[model samples]
Every structure is written in C-alpha cells, then in structure tokens.
Target: MSNDILRLNIPPEEPNLDPNTVCKTYPELSQEQYSLCFEHPDVTASAIQGIQVAIHECQHQLKEYRWNCSSLEKKNKNPHASPLLERGYKETAFAYAISAAGVTHQVAKACSLGKLKSCGCDMSLHGKIRQKWEWGGCSHNVEFGEDFSKKFLDSKERKARDIHGRINIHNNRAGRLAVIKNVNRQCKCHGMSGSCELRTCWKATPEFREVGKRLRRKYEKARKVDILNKATARYRRIRKQTRRTELVYYERSPNYCDPNPLVDSPGTSGRLCNKTSDGVDNCETLCCGRGYNTLRVRRTERCDCKFHWCCYVVCQTCHYNEWVTVCK
Candidate 1:
C-alpha cells in the first residue's frame, strides 16, 4: 500500500486512548508525519478529519464533471487504487491543494473550539482593526494551522525532492493560502435592544463549501507547467517565477470519459446523465457523444406528508414513472 495517509485505506475505528500511541496506530503515515504527530500529540485526530473533509468537498465540487473525483472513492475491491494521485494532472494538483486546505481549516477550527490543547483562538490580531473593534470572539488560528499543515502534509514530499515533490509542495501551499485569503471578519453586537452600540469582531474561516468553490475556480484556470527535476536550473527558475496561489501541473489529464484502470479512472459509462439540461452533467457533454440509453422506470416514494394535530406525521406511498438516461 502507498504511504499516503490520505489514501482511502483508512485506519479502522480508532479506540479512544492516548496521544502518544498515534505512531503505533497509524502505521501507514510516513516517518516524518509520524514524528510530527509525536511532537504535537493532540493534532492527529483533527488531521484525520481534515482529510475526510477534503475528500467530501472534492466529490461535492466535481459531481457534475466527467472526472467527478471518482479515483478517490473508497472501495473494498480496490484498496490500492490511487494511480490518479500518482500523476501530475491538474486534477491531482487540485487534490493536493484541497487536502492541505482541509487540514489547515480543520486544525484551525479545532483550536478555536477548544478541541486541541496545544492551541487556541488566534491571538495575532493587531493594528487599525483592533482600534475599531475588540477581537473578543474566537478567531480561527489559521496561521498555526497553515504552519502545522506544511510541516506534516509536506513532510513526505520534502524527502523526495523531485519534480513531483515540487509540484505537490506548490499546490499544497496554494491550498493553505486559499484558506487564509477567504478568512472573513465576523462580529456580534452586545447592545440590549439589538442596537449597533458595541461590536466585537473576529476573523473566521469561510465555509468549506466556499473554499471548495475557490479551489474549483483555480482548477479551471490551472497553469500548465513544464516538468523538470529539482536539480535543473530551469526548475528553480520556474519555481521562483510562479505565483503562490496558482495551481500548477506538469501532465495533461486523459479526459476521464472512458474507464482506464491504469490510472484508476472509472470512466463515465453507466453514469446517470441529464438529457434536457445543457449543463456539464447533460448527456451530450458527459457521455462524450457516445449517446445515452433512456429507460422508463417507476420510483416508489413517500409523499403527501401531513402533520397530525398532536405531533406525529403520516405520508402516503406514491409511484411515479420517469425517464432515466444513462451514458452508453
């Protein structure tokens, strides 16, 4: 199995015990990540949640597209299915960024919510903003989250020092920056009669959905980079010139319309497609002009729900026929 901690071969339900046992529990983690877990002690649980959040958001953002982030799907049949992650496609770049962002976001939120003992609400606020409003609310300590994410997520890549490693590092940083850039100022009023007399504001991370949208936009405008080893002078020059927030990738993706087991791409065949809409999910775009098969099927659902005078609710079983289109 790959050493990637984010892979679908998740560790089984962890028994609640102690922080010092993290290394022993998650043996799949790289040596560097294990060491970081050992040092922080309290951040490992949150980091695991971060990965799950990243995967969920990725699936949500790409649900309408052809690729649909299916390579990351967890299946009992294919525990080692991660060829897409092995490539340097723009999709891979997105995965890296979103995953890192997930870690940074989750960790920061954990700190603010008192879930992590090592950290708490960000205390770095200063300057003209403090002059206007009191920083009393819990601000997500994103800076600390970003730093910790870099130390742990980027650890495996640091050991490689190859072109792939550089690309991963760049995209990972872009993910962290996405979280930082989207931090919003949230405030609450303390006046009795809902008056604007006093306001206390604190920095808050944007909803993860918003972060997913931001990263999706970056994926659409991803920069195609020339592949090169870290030792090359051209590689250094490109690294210096590239913008920090831009997503960069070296390899072109193989248009995920057809299943390619080689890359773990479970193509669009047999996928449901909308026949009438002109969106990316429509049959014309999703099926890649192979045409789709329409089947009339009856669906049974609970409808006509009514609330009784007391508290209980009742619903009637309804049957309806609909035309379902599937990619050929």
Candidate 2:
C-alpha cells in the first residue's frame, strides 16, 4: 500500500526503428501498457499518466495475489472442495484484471489533459485479447485443485513474455524521448518536478496508503467469512430438510347432509307438508318414512363410500340403471 513512486528507467528507443517492428518483437504488453503508448503518449499529453496508471494496475495485481493466496489457503483446509475454491480464484482474478485495466484507463483519462483515443488497434481488439488470455489460453488450461503456486508461476512467465515485447518497442529512441518529455511535463504539472519542489501529490500520501491497506484487509476477511458461512448455511439447510414423496391426503366433509334437511325438500314442492291422522296439513315434520327422507338417506350412503383404481371393490348396491367398470 506504499505510495512511494518507483522510478522506472524508460530511456528513449532508437530513432531509426519502426514502432510496429518493435511491437511485433514483444507480445507481452498488457492492454494497460499498450493503451498508454497508443493513446496519451501518441498525442500531445505527458505519458506519466500511463506510468501512474501502470502503478495503479500493479497495486490491483498485488491485491489479487493476496486474495488468491488467501483463497488457496482456505481451500487447502477443505481438500475435498478445492476445485470449487480454485474456480472462484480464477473467476475473481480474471474479473479483477479486466476491471483494474478499465479503471486504470479511466483514471488516466481523468488525470490527463488530453482525451482518450483508439490505439489504432481494432475496437474489438481488447475484448478479443482478454478472451484469449482468460478463456482459451493458459488461464483456461490451468487445472483447479492442482498446484496453485505452479499455476501462478506460469502466469508470471506469460506476463514476462508479454511485457518484454512491449518494453522493447517503447525502448525506441524517439518514442522513449517523447514519453520522457510527456512524463516530465505531467510530473511538473502536478508540481512533482523541477522548481515545483513537491516530492509527491496527495495520491502518494501515507493516509491514502493506510486506507488502501485497511480496506483490502477488511474485504479479504469479509470475503472469506462469507464463503464459509454461505457454504455451512447451505449444508445445514439441506441436512435439516427432508424430501417427501407421498401425496397429501385431505379429509373433506360430505355435502349431502344438513341440520335442516327436511326444510326445503323437493318432494314438498317448496312448501312444508305434514301427513297426520287429523288431515293433510301444511306443517314441518321430522319423519323418517317421508319420500324426501328416503332420497336424502340414499344420497348420504352413496357419498360415504370410497373407491380406488387398481383395487378390488364390488358395489353391494349396484342397482343403478347405468353402471361403468374400470380396471387398472
């Protein structure tokens, strides 16, 4: 998290050399570095913005390294779940790398006096390159749960190969001088060069360094805790819950019977009827021998019965005019 600027010796390249030829020799230049050369430096602005961007990107790389290391260590304790942990590391690393590059580009543009321009590379070039590195090439071939240290070492090798090519191109005398002048101007603009007498800006403050360090530590701790807690919670939920297979049976009351069954009998033609020794009279009565009572009793008996397919059942009251049989 140190804000101390590390001075890189970026001497001018040979003036007679071709930029394309030099670029061809080194394929390792990350998108961030290439962008610096192509955008701000190619224009009138100081390339120091690019260097600062590189520093920011380096910090991101360092943070990613720490995160990955922590993940690997955590996974080691759970050897059975190492593959998933490794995948997490790779996915996080790829996303972080891409995001860091983009942020660096944005910060460079914001800090610089000039605007961002296309590096003459195709609009899709950055995306394509990132895909190749992250999905198709070495990054993809790396196995999860294997030797993470060796995988990191291989990554470093690939990065070194890429950087060597880019630096060689920037080594050209004219390009180097241009970059140096641009950087010097940028430094002076920020009052970090010549008679300005300021050693560094607020960006290089100790408070900022401490903040960055504390934030990174907190993020790492939170991430680890979250991973562990989520996994445990999921496992506990799965273990505590049981799977069911039987259909839920609901016992429903029959709709045939009523407390006042004879009140509205169809046999009465919407009127209360009473048959007694006195005479036929319009009166309500509870008689079991009534025609409406017989119908109600029969319906209730039918409703109380239960039938199932693929079973043996012979209806004792099979006196219905129309009957159907089904076999399972």
Candidate 3:
C-alpha cells in the first residue's frame, strides 16, 4: 500500500478514454487491479465507495481520540499520502484493517443487490440442509469480496519485501476477517401457521459500525511483533501463538498531542473538547494539558414542525447559543 487507492480515478467526462491513457486514471492501483477496472467498472466504483465508507467510519471511531483521522481530509493533496499510514503504529494497524473490511462489506453487499455481472447471490447457502433452517434469501457473496480485496488491495503490499509491508498485509487480512466475523445469520420461519417445523436463513452483512467497534477494541490491544523471516523458528513460534484476527504493530505511535512534521500530525490546537468529562475527549487529555478556550456560538436548525391535512409539513427555524470548549 505505498499509495492509496483512494486516488483511483476514472473521470466521468471521459467515458471512452483508452485503457493505457497515461496511467493517471488508476495511478494507485496495480496493473491487475486496473485491468479489472477496465472490464468491470462497477467493481471499481464499488471499491472506491468501500474506501469512502472506511474513511467515514475511521473518523467516527477516532472522533474523540488524538490523531482523529483528519489527515485523510487534506484538500488538493493526496489523502493517502498521509504519514498516519506510513508507520506501524496502532492507528496504522486500524487503518489498514478498517479499509480492508470496508471493501469486503461493500463488495459483498453489492453482490446481494445485483450490482455486478460477474458476481451474484452467494449460492453456497441456497441448497444446504442445516437442521431446521433452509437457505432461502440472497446471501452476501463475501468470498468474492475477499478475492477482489486480495487481488486489488493486496497487490501493492505484496511487492514490498519489508516488515511494514508484512504488517499492512496482516492488518488488511485482519480487517477482512473482522467483516467475515460480523456476517449475520438471518433466519425466517417457514413452518406451519403456528408450528415451528422449518426455517429459511440467509447470511447478511452486519452493521459496519459493529466492524468498527471490533477493530477499535483490537486497536486497544494490538500486539507488537518483530520478525523478518518466516523461515525462522521465532517467526514460526510467534505466528503459532498469535491469532490471525488480532492486530499487530511494529513501532510505537508518534506523539499525537503535538504536530509532527515527520508523521504529518496536526496538533489538537483549537479542536473541540469536552471540559466537563474525565475521558479521552476531555480538554485535559485531548489538549495535552495546554488548557482550552470557551466560546458561545449560535446555530440554527429546523425546530417545530406541523403536518397539514394533505400537504407537506411546515417547520420553524430555531437558533440557539451554547458554550463550547476548544483545545488551546
């Protein structure tokens, strides 16, 4: 993952551009990935969407923490070029995992929605006889997502012959595993009116927030590992001891309290914080003890609404002022 696939481009205006047109269209994707993009444009769009989901979820999960995923939001600059991803810190581990999981979730859900020609409903469950429940509904084709992610997302990291590359690959797989683990088993009754004799079941994608929560927990307990060669005895022992679902890191995180040019971290200066709580989002912790400033701000929103007999509802605009805290 030297570069971010978030930069993958296929301009809407140029619908008939040549596949070999300057390579700028897919500067981030490998040859194989871009090749598929030319054939399956829908999949490429879905991949981008998956990354967007990952970014949104990442921001949501880290909203109250330092290094709150704001680097992925730099305008005009390549967001993937953020230093947040270059190191083997716990945040990097979570980034790789969540991005991979996001791709899996979107791709699988796309299959169920008939959005791709190459993939469709997962028939693996359709004919299976598992006790009382029969596979009936369209199950998410996670296998397709896993394969696409491996081919597309894993392409770059597979070329690197270093430990960081290995870390990215591991975290990527861990993220996909997180999505797979959260796949829900949905069932419906197929028996007589009031009798419970048989049931219909389908595998569905669980809420992406659940995946984020699981990865956040793993980030809290991420393990540090150092191994250059899989042929060595220590590597074997560590691999044997560590579960694949767990996140692994190689280096300690940077001081996120202050701006670090090396890692492109923006200090928490002026960031909103909760002054009344003793938590990660509190001014003391988030501001790095630099104190904070209080300000009264007013904002407006739709307030009271009333529905007419056969028409739309009317609402009144309301403005209110509230005191806010910002890191100094």
Q: Which is the leading candidate under TM-score?
A: 1
User: Best to worst by TM-score, what's the order?
Assistant: 1, 3, 2
Q: Which residue runs does candidate 1 get wrong by more than 4 Å?
A: 1-27, 75-81, 126-132, 228-233, 296-322
Q: Return whichever of 1 and 3 wins on TM-score.
A: 1
Q: Estimate each model's TM-score.
A: 0.81, 0.21, 0.81
Query: What is the lDDT, from 0 to 100, of the residue 216 in candidate 3?
Result: 90
List, residue by residue over 1-328, the lDDT tens digit for candidate 1. Answer: 1213332232334323244444455436777877777767567656755765687689889988898875774632221126787788998899899989988998888788875768998877633345446766789999889988998788888887778888889999999999999899998887889785777888899988899999999999999887544345255766787899999988889989898978778999987899888789999999989999988988786555432211123557899888889899
Best candidate according to lDDT? 1
Error of model 2, residue 111, in angstroms: 5.3
Candidate 3 lDDT over residue span 126-202, tens digit each: 97878887888899999998888777677777776466776788889999999987788988876679465887889
lDDT of 2 by residue, 1-328 (tens): 1111212122223211123422232234445444433433322122222223323433443331312222212211311122321222222322222222222222233232222232221122122322113111111111110122112112323354432211111111111122122221111112434544332211111122232343233223321111233223332232233211101111111221122222211122222223332322312222222332211111111111221110111223333332221111
CA lDDT scores, all candidates in order = 0.76, 0.24, 0.74
lDDT of 3: 0.74
Pairs of colliding residues, candidate 3: none
Which candidate would rank higher by TM-score, 2 or 3? Answer: 3
